[model samples]
Target chain A: MTPALLDAPAEDRLAAAIGEMARRSSSAVAIVAQAGSAARCTIDYGWLSRAIVSLEAGIDAGRPVGIVARAARVETLVVIAAACGRQHVPVAFLAEDSRDLVGQLRDWVEVDDSLSLPAAAAGERGRREFETVPPQVIVATSGTSGPPKLVDHSWDSLLAAARLAEHWHGLGWLLAYDATRWAGIQVWVQALLTGGRLVVPASRDPDVVARALVEESVAILPATPTLLRRLLTSADRGLLCRSGLDRITLGGEAADAALLEEAQATFPQAKITQVYATTELGEVYRVADGRAGFPAAWLGKALPGCVRLAVRRDGELLVRLSRDTAEVGTGDLVQRRADRYEFTGRRSDVIVVGGAKVYPKRVEEIVRGVPGVAECRIYGLPSPVTGELVAGEIALADPLPENATPESVRAAVLAVCREHLEPHSVPRILDIVKQIATTPAGKTPRKPHS
Target chain B: MRPDVPNAIVTAIATVLRDTGRDTRPIESGMLLAGDLGLDSLDLAQTIVLLERSLGCDPFRSASTSRSVRTVADLIAIYDSAVAPGAS
Candidate 1:
């Protein structure tokens, strides 16, 4: 544990590793907590140490402490590190309802309890010093998105990822995303290792996130394709007029050409990186240029000791342990291109509309091309006439350009789909939204409208 | 198609819920899943296994169809449609 602190520079250590980051970095506001206007708060490490002490105390009790936190908060970082240090198995839950979340936890635990930072800090210091423990992380799976499946990870697994990430980029602003599930867990660990500042905006709104590139002096942004498209244009323009960000990384969902181009246009100064990781396998690939499609080239050779990637006969991605023999078959459908591979969609995401096979991305790509549409998600529904029908959920850019009604947007989307797809591939039910509800990582919820 | 097929599934699902000591009503096509029954994401996985074992139908393989089966009726419709040809 002492070497963990000695091995890293002060800037790269966790709040628990360094004695006074919260106090010394008073001017460098580390986190901004925002809900509405007045409820917003910002803090440096000075006040944060108190919160960490509370987390440390809870972990000392040998109780499994679970944290349900807002994204990009320093308190979130401290609690995680404290849980890790105190040997307390830390479980994080990010879902829609607290009540429902409690219900889900019922099977796992008999007693329900919550620890608030403000309350925990009320007591004075005790003799209990936090101890290092074996790490376990529980991440919810998409199949269980309505409720999440807990995936566990070890300290070695998480640290290996950090070392690999540090090998790629030295230090800069880490644009962290709360990709719906456990993906966000990596963001915190990466920041702790790199000793770089974490940048989040006043809101998850793409516009605010874009502006923050200039306002916060951002450098590295890791996100899903859904969010990359939204912030790219604004960040690019903001960068041109002022200081710019450096890197944009996409994962969680596949990014199409249009989406990648949009991100490049937004942050022209940033390098575009793609990630191939899952809850099962920490991080399989680090596509620095978003080229190479297969994990074999990216993970097998490049990060040889880190991960092993294989493609099954049906084009499904498989991961074998880099150091061991555990093999994991991923459900994502992929295509190999010369030296690189690309994600097609989820095996479970395919829909048979009418008699033809329809992929949600195929229709989603076409629908995204329509003017005035901000974001869209496509799924299949059982149709009496066609066996399955393409259905879509859409969010419009505010003040839907001149004459852009939901009908017109649907018409434009349909016309594009019709031109490129069979009639069966066209969406039959199109629901409009003020904004698409997305998980922190930037993935559209499987049942977006629901 | 026999009218009893859908009824049998509806009755079985209700019984499963009841066996868990959950007070449930007779199954209707319109009953919302998450809202009407406390069956959540975990419950759905549990229900799917239970339904497969009880109904003795081929394990539902299609994701597109799984996405469409939102309600008890939707599940019943899928099960009923599959049983129709065999029941004849």
Candidate 2:
């Protein structure tokens, strides 16, 4: 494939595209690679072509010989995050320290840093300003931090509960997450079963994933709400519209009404589905008709006597796998909103600043009330002193605060929080971000205190 | 032991006290955090956190730290020994 068009000035990009198409593929690759080769840059097309060919051979042999991933310092993270295509060998990402967890997989192979490119040049390659987060994404790390999770699952075990539909036939499904991941594996099987196309992007970068979706004429897209938000924020609106997306499945994280409304407006043609799944429970529940959570009526109702969904008094969603099984906790909290139950946050989503419980939702609401604040997200940062310190990611309203610094906006938010919240609930850290980092699973680990 | 540990501890306590709209006067070494200074457990946590950032160490990490620290001096002593050369 020719080098993907650069997110440069429209006219300059067009000229560069025309010139590259004239000069040939390698010239086009060199131009893109040369533009930014200082941080972590995307793998050049020349390298990707070799990797794809190797990928085909590896899958045919049914053995994973490492396909050198492109990112320098984050090569392992890239391979783990993008676990690009359907793998015959079931892959599970383990934390570097969890040596024991590796035993859970009998034939698992570690995709190490023996990457295709040298560490020196790979790291030096350019990462853009828009790509705020490094390639070391949170989703790749201990999926929702606790005891390092080990999901000992195979294609058959995961597909045991899948409800197949004839409508899945011939639709192009975008592999928007780690293919080894539960959601990714499910998408792959659905595509395989339906004789449909699974468009696996070479990179998790929104630009690359969005381009693949559009260029491949992908009809079905499965992604986390965070990934969908990133795609909407990063991709050109016109380019996104070019894709014939008939279905958008959001899972792996909670989907809010605002995000649902935004996605609905962006792709009115596509039907949105909010699905919730866990490593323990394959695909727990699904909600359609453009709502945040499943219908309250679905609560306490058993799904074919296989998986029954219920909520705790404190709001955690509980699922009973079968008639004989005890209710298993999903760690997600849900709230009844008129006709439906909307997932509020995870049970552990609270920020306990010192000894007091500081709800992120409460803090986010107060932060959003500040004069210039248009949007805000609340999360905790690890601190030895307090159990965890409260942090806020704030996006400003239009007509920018005349040369506003993060410091200035933070000071204003601090003033408001102090009045409404307890002494311990005030956010210690605040960032004025253009777009909060949510591209790759927005759940940044609230690292346990030492 | 570092000479500035007592002074640093006092400063951190004062900072947390200021944020909570409490009196920021006469932060003596013998002043009990909860009793005399009116600093709650969370306020004490804030003080320890601030001290860790400024002093570049957390004594609680190496040595067993009691939740109920009686006075400012006890808190200072814990950190002072932590930063001492050859200290754990």
Using Cα atoms with residue i matched to residue i, what is each candidate's TM-score against the true structure? 0.67, 0.63
lDDT of 1 by residue, B1-85 (tens): 2456566667656654643346777667788877877654433543554445466653354444544656878877777776666
DockQ for each candidate? 0.02, 0.24
Model 1 chain A is weakest, by summed lDDT over 10 consecutive residues, at A106-115
- CAPRI band for model 1: incorrect
Show the colliding residue pairs in model 2: A36-A126, A37-A124, A37-A125, A37-A126, A38-A124, A38-A125, A38-A126, A39-A125
For model 2, residues A174-264, the per-residue Cα lDDT tens digits are: 7775544445545654553343455667566666776777766788888877678667756677777776788898877777777788788
All candidates: interface RMSD:
16.2, 3.0
Put down candidate 1 lDDT per residue, A284-306, tens digits, no spaces.
Answer: 66666644354435534425456
Model 1 chain A TM-score equals 0.77
Give the residue spans of candidate 2 off by over 4 A: A1-143, A147-150, A160-166, A232-244, A302-307, A321-326, A348-358, A361-403, A415-424, A429-442, A448-450, B1-39, B60-81
